[model samples]
Target: MSVPLILTLLAGAATFIGAFLGVLGQKPSNRVLAFSLGFAAGIMLLISLMEMLPAALDTEGMSPVLGYGMFIIGLLGYFGLDRLLPHAHPQDLVQKRQQPLPGSIKRTAILLTLGISLHNFPEGIATFVTASSNLELGFGIALAVALHNIPEGLAVAGPVYAATGSKRTAIFLGRYLRHGGNFWRRAGVADFGQPGFANRYGGYHGSSRRYYGGALRR
Candidate 1:
C-alpha cells in the first residue's frame, strides 16, 4: 500500500532474477560477472557521494564540519566493511572441472549465506528508514540495494546448484529463501519505523528456519 513497502518488495524480489540466472545450465562468464559487480559498486558509491552526502549536508541544523565528519566516517565504515566481507564472485562458482575449489563447496555456500544474511539485515533497516524519511530517497536506496543483491544471489546459487544439482533445493536454499530475509527485515522496519529491531528478530529468524527446512531435496 505504501510507497516504501512497494519499493522494498520490488527491490527484494530482484534476487529472483539472479537466482534464475544461477539455476541455468551455464553460468555467466567472468567478464559479465565482473561488469555487473562493478556497476553495482559504482551505483552504491555514487548514491552515497552524490545523493546521500549532499542531502545530509543540506539538512537543517547540520553543520558543514559535522557533515564532512559524517561523510568521512561513512567512507571509513564502507571501506572497513569492504575489507571484512569475503564476497563470492559468480565466476568462481561455475562447474568447470579444469581447476577445483580448495575447500568444501557446501561449507563455502553456508558461510557465504551466513555472511550475506547478517550483512543484509542492517541494510534492510537502513533502506526502510531512509525511504520512510524521503520517498524519492528511498527509491534510490532500494535500487542500489537491489543492484548488489542480484550478484549476491547469483554468487550463492551458482555454486550450490553446481554442487548439489538440484534446482528446487538450490533456488529455495540459496537465493529465494535468503532473499526473504531481506524482505521481512525491511518490512519489519517499515512497519515499525520508530523502533525496528524487536520484531525483526522474530521475522527474519522465521524466514531462516523456513529457508533451511524447506529446501526440498531431490
Candidate 2:
C-alpha cells in the first residue's frame, strides 16, 4: 500500500485505541484529554491557515477571488451541516443523569455513531488528499486526526458498553461504524488533483467549526 494509504489506515485505526479504553472504563484524565485535543486543534489551525490555504491561493491560474470564495463556502457549509445534523455530542452523553435507561443510551450511541461517521467521511477525504500531496504534512494531519478520533471512539463505545455490557459489540461498532463510508471513499482519492484549494480550504473550515463548536459547547 502507498504511504498515504498507510497513514490513512493508521489514523482511522486510532479509533480502536479509544474504543478499547472506553470498554475498559478507563478514560484519559480530563487534563490529558484537553491538552491533546487542544494541541491537535492548534495543528489543524496552523496547517489550514499557514499551509493549506496559502498553497491553494498560490496555485498558478487560481484567482484570488475564487480561492477565498471557496474558503468561505467551506466555512458556511460546515456550519450548515452542523445545524442540520441530528448528532449527539459525546459531552451530552457524559453529562446525562446517572443510571439513565439502557435503551436510551443505546439509541444515543447509535445516533452519535451516525453523526461521527458523517464527520469522519470528509475527514478521511481530506487526510488522503493532504497525504498524497505532501507526506510530511499528511503525517501531521493524520496524527492530529488520530488524536481527536480517540475521544470519538470513547464517546461511541462508552454508551454502547453501558447499554449492552458487551465489550466485543461496543468495540466492533465503535471501530467500524465510526468510519462508515470513509473506507469505501478512500478509492476515490485517485480521482482528485494534488491537494487543491477546494479540498484543503473546506477541510480546514470543517475542522475549525468542529473543534470550535465543541469548545463552545463545553
Candidate 3:
C-alpha cells in the first residue's frame, strides 16, 4: 500500500482505543468518566493553542489576520452548529429510553450521524493528501489528528449505545475492527470463541471530545 494510505489507516484505527474506553464491558464510573473528560479536554486545549494554532500561523505565506479570522470562524461555526443540533446526552438517554423519545429525537440522532460522517470524511483525505505532499509533515499531522480523534470514537459510540442499546449497530457505525478478544476474555464480558480478529471495535468521528466530556455533566 501507498504511504498515505498506510498513514490514513493507522490514524483512522486509533478510534478503536477510544471506543474500547467508552463501550467495553461496562460504562466507566462517573468519576472515571469525569477524569477522562478532564484529561481529554486538557489535551485538546493545549494542543490547539501550542501546536495547531502555531502551525497555522507558521504556514507559509499565511497572514496572521487571515489565520486568526479563520480560527474564530471555526470556533463560532462549531458552537453555532452545536446549538443547532438536538444532541442527546448519554446520561439522559437512560431516562429518555424508559420513556419513548419522540420520533424527532430518533431523527435527531440519525441526522447527527449523517452530518458527522460527512464532516469527518475529510480527515482521511487530509491525511492522505498531506502525507503524499510531505512525509514528515504528514506524519506529524496524522499523529496529531489521530490523537485528537480518539475521543471521537467515544463521542460516536457512547451516545448511540445509550440511545439504541444495540452494540452491533455501534460497532458498524464506528467502522474499525481488528482485535478485542483478549480484553473481553479477561473482563469476562464475552467469549468470542475464535482466534485472530475475533472481536470488533466500534467508534465514530467528527464530534470530538466535547461530546464525550459533556455527556458526563450532572
Candidate 4:
C-alpha cells in the first residue's frame, strides 16, 4: 500500500483499538495507565529533540539561524492558536470530577473525540508529507506522532469509561481498545505479565534512582 494509505490504516486501527479498549469493560490499573502516559510523554520528548527539530534545521540550504527561527515561529504559532481556543481536556472529568453531570458525559465524550480528531488531522498530513520526502525523516515523524497520539487515546478513553461505565459504548464513541490476550501478546505478553513490569524492566526504577540520587548529591 501507499504511504498515505498505510498511515491512514494505522490511524484507523489505533482509533479502533482505543474504542475496543473502552468497550471491553476492563479498567486498566492506575499504574498501568500512568506508565502509558509517561511512555507517551517520553516518546514525544525524544522525537521533538531528535527528529522534528533537527529536520526543521536541515531543510534545503537554510541557515541554522533561519531554520531555528522558523522552528521557534512554528512553536509560537501553535501556542498562540492553542491559547485562542477553549482548552479541551480529555481527562478533565477523569482527574477532577468536580463538574459534568452524568447526563452530559456522553456529550462530553463526543466533543472530546471530535477535538482529538481535528487536532490530529494536521499531524497526519505532516507525517504523510515528511515520509513522502525522506524515509528516515518520515520514520522519525511517525514515531513522534504516534507517541503524541497514545496519551490522546487515554484521554478519550478515561473520561468516557469514567462517566458511562460501559466499555463497549465508550469504545464505539471514542475509538479506544481494551487490553486483551491478543493485544498483550502483540505488545509483548511476558513484559506486561510480569509484576511491577514497568518498574522492574522498563526503566522506571533506574530513572527514579538516578534522578533522586542526583537530587541528593546536589
Q: Provide the clash count, candidate 1.
A: 0
Please, what are the lDDT tens digits per residue for candidate 3 over residues 38-103? 664565455445544565566555566766665566566556655765443334323214554454
- 103-135: candidate 2 lDDT, tens digit per residue: 877887887777777666556666676676678
Q: Is candidate 1 or candidate 3 better by TM-score?
A: 1
Those runs of model 3 whose alpha carbons end farther than 4 Å from true positions after fitting are 1-11, 14-25, 93-108, 121-166, 176-218
Q: List the residue pairs that clash in candidate 2.
A: none
Error in Å for residue 1 of model 1 = 3.7
- In model 2, where do residues sit more than 4 Å from their true spots? 88-100, 178-181, 184-218
Most accurate candidate by lDDT: 2
lDDT of residue 120 for candidate 3:
41
The residue pairs that clash in candidate 1, if any, are none
From the highest TM-score down, the ranking of the candidates is: 2, 1, 4, 3
- Each candidate's TM vs. the true structure? 0.72, 0.80, 0.53, 0.60
Give lDDT per model, in order: 0.60, 0.66, 0.48, 0.48
Q: Write the per-residue lDDT of candidate 4 for residues 1-218, one digit (tens) a residue.
A: 56643553354345544444444534456566567556655655555555555654555444566555545554565555456533343334363245554867666766666655544544454444445445565565456455445555656666776776666666665542322212322233233322365435543222222221122111
Error of 1 at 85 (Å): 3.9
- Model 3 whole-model lDDT (C-alpha atoms): 0.48
Point out the worst 10-residue segment of candidate 3 by lDDT: 201-210
Kindly give the number of clashing pairs for every candidate: 0, 0, 1, 16
